[model samples]
Target: MKALVLAAGTGTRLRPVTHTGAKQLVPIANKPVLFYALEAISAAGIANVGIVVEPNADDIKKAVGDGSRFGVDVTYICQEQPLGLAHAVLVSQDFLGSDDFLMYLGDNYVGGGVTSVVEAFRHDRPSARILLTQVPDPTAFGVAELDDTGRVASLEEKPTRPKSDLAVMGVYLFTSEIHEGIREIKPSARGELEITHAIQWLIEQGRDVTATVNTSYWRDTGNVADILEVNRHVLDTTEGPGAAAGEVDPDSTLIGEVHLEEGARIVRSWVEGPVVIGAGTLITDARIGPYTSIAEDCRVSGSAIRSSILLSGSTVDGVSAIADSLIGRHASITTAAAGGDSHRLVLGDHTRIALAG
Candidate 1:
């Protein structure tokens, strides 16, 4: 089996961050979201992968060149526009010719990977299989209705009145027969060729459309809150033995599962983990709280931060407290004057802010 990974979407919701970089490249725990998806594809025993990328996404291309590092041979397919999932599949027909493939979204995080599901798909040989999970807001996703026998009875894309809570997870397994289905379906009301329509087409023709409810953790890291939540989840679950690769001053206090990368220095500060300090980052006289990830080349001094993510080259100095935030790369947060006021900010790349009266 092969894999088709979509990384072409213009992430409008993510705003200024996505404006400059691919949403798939956003880091969760200092790792790009796209890297996690690629890792999962590799773990599924599928080495022939085709990555769908938007035009001018050179950064993504540079980061994931040839996929050799991930033990997969990658063929980059340019998806000219932000059409739709089905459109992506349509354009990738040549790369995916005559082979069953897994379509995985680059920004989606699936805990435990898709090894089990890939094995099941290989054994069962369903015409198409979709991963489904119960979501609180089904209207935001492509939902599925299951028959009594647990087959996919129907599918709808972001319906206003969803029939079921089973939202389609971003992972899909499809045989070549899906090509015909895609050809037959028309664009949805949103002017994009919806994948749900193609799946529904297959169901109408009596194709074996199967659904699996994923009980494992799954999240679409689209916005700031979701990204932070997924980051916290990754930190909480995978924080095993604390290994500090960098220098820690005798005066600093390290607590709980903190991973400090090479060149990261902590001096006279208190760091509470489940936190990861990236390479070349310096923490001095600061209180780094739990569930926080500070990316490479950052500096935090005289500040207290908790439950936040700071991208590479960011600086936090003389801030009283910061929580529940996502600070972009090369950003700076500092105090203008001594004040008791607290600050909350969702800053984008290259931002600079001085908190004061």
Candidate 2:
């Protein structure tokens, strides 16, 4: 079996960070989100993998080249536009020819991996298998309606009045039978071919389409709030006192579950985790704790950052406190007023701001 990872979407919700980098490349626990999907797929014993990407595919290519690093044979399938999920599958037909495949959204985070899901699908060999999870807002996702027997009866894409709370997760298992379904589907009102429509087509034709409700954590890291939520979820369950690879000064005090990637420097600071400090980042005389991720090459000094995500190349000057925020790449936050603005911010492209004040 092969795996097809859809990563072509231009993450408009993530803004400045996605402006500079792919949302799938965003880091959690100092590891890219794409890496998690790749790792899980690799663990599921699927080797031949195809990644669907947009025009900005160079960065992804550079990051996962040939997939050898992740123990899989990588193939890049170009999608000229972010049309939709079904469109992505239609474009990858050649790469996925004749083989049962798994489609994983590169930005989605599924706890405990998909090895079990793969096993269950392999055992059943249905026309299509989709993962579902109970989400608070089913209208935001492809919602599913189950029958009295608990089998999925129908599925709708972002319905106004959802029939069930079971929202379709990003992962999918499909046989070549889906090719015809994809071809028969029409574009939705959003001007994109919806995957949910194709699945509904299969159902209309009496194909056996199954769904597994995920009790484990699963998140479609689409918006800023969901991204931070996923980070927090991962940190909460990850093993305590994460892998340390970089330098820690003698004066620094590290506490709780923290992940310091290689080349990270912690000096004269108190870091309490559930936190991930990426490579080449420097932390000095600061307090980083309980759900904070400081990305690569960032500098933090004499500041306190909690429950925040500071993207690569950001800087927090002395006496600053950034809490429950998402700081864009190369952004500068300082306590000193600039042009009488109390706090100064030199933000990057596509940046989003929600200040407490």
Candidate 3:
């Protein structure tokens, strides 16, 4: 079987960050979220993969290359616009051909990978199979209604009144019969051909459709909170036995599960983990708390940070007590030279602030 990974969507919800970068490229624990999808596809033993991308996304090409690194031979199919899931499949018909394939959203995060689900799809050979997760807000997702026999009975794309809470995940396995369904359904009220509608079309035609509820971790990282949450979960599960490959000064202390990448230096600081410090970052006179990830080439000094992500090249100095925040790349965050009772901040567009001083 082949695979089609959709990476062309414009992440409107993750503004400012998505304005300059692809949402799929957002890092969780210093690893691109798209890489996790590609890794899952490669692990499933599907080597023939087609990635649907924007008209001219060289950044994605540069990051993923030919997919040889991930054990897949990638064919890049350009989607003219950020249409919809069904439209992505329709455009990838040339690359997908007649093969049974998996369609994975490049920005979604599925814990433990999709290997076992792929195996089940291969064995059962359902005409269409969707991965579902019970979400608190079903209105924000394409939801599925399953029968007592576990077959998918109906599907709805972000319905105001959802019949069920089983939100369809970003992954789906489908045979060529889905192509017929995609062609049969009209664009929804949202002006795009949603995959849920196509699957619903198949159900109307009496095709065997099924779903697998992902009891394990699964999140759609379209916003900052979700991204940070996924990052924390990934670090807790994957950081494994800590390896401080980088230099740790005698004055510094590292505790718990901490993985320091090569060239990362810690001086006169204390860092506790489930945390990962990326390559070449320096930590001085800081207290790095658990569930935080500091990306490469960053500097953190005289601060206490917990549960935050500092992107590449960001500097945090003097200002203390940060939590549940995402600092963008090359951004410098510091206090004014003179100490004051009143707080002062130079904020950017879409910047959220809660002063604790």
What is the per-residue lDDT of model 3 for residues 283-356, given as tens digits with 9 covering 90 to 100? 99999979999899998898888887777888877776778877776667776655533333322233434343
Query: What TM-score does candidate 3 reach?
Result: 0.94
lDDT of 1 by residue, 1-357 (tens): 999999999988787777778999989988999999999999889999999999888999999999999999999999998889999999999999999999999999999799999999999999999999999999999999999999999999999999999999999999999999999999888889998899999999999999899999999998989999999999998754465588899999988889998899999999998899999999999999799999999999999999999989999999988998888889988888757657767788898999872
Evaluated against the true structure, the overall lDDT of model 1 is 0.92
Pairs with steric clashes in candidate 2: 16-350
The C-alpha stretches of model 1 lying farther than 4 A from their native spots are 338-340
Least well predicted 10-residue stretch by lDDT in candidate 1: 237-246
Candidate 2 vs candidate 3: the TM-score winner is: 3
All models, RMSD in angstroms: 1.2, 2.9, 2.8
Which numbered prediction scores highest in TM-score against the true structure? Answer: 1
Clashes in each model (backbone N, CA, C under 3 Å)?
0, 1, 0
Best-to-worst order by TM-score is 1, 3, 2
Residue 279 lDDT, candidate 2, scale 0-100: 86
Task: Name the candidate that leads on lDDT.
Answer: 1
Candidate 2: C-alpha RMSD to true structure equals 2.9
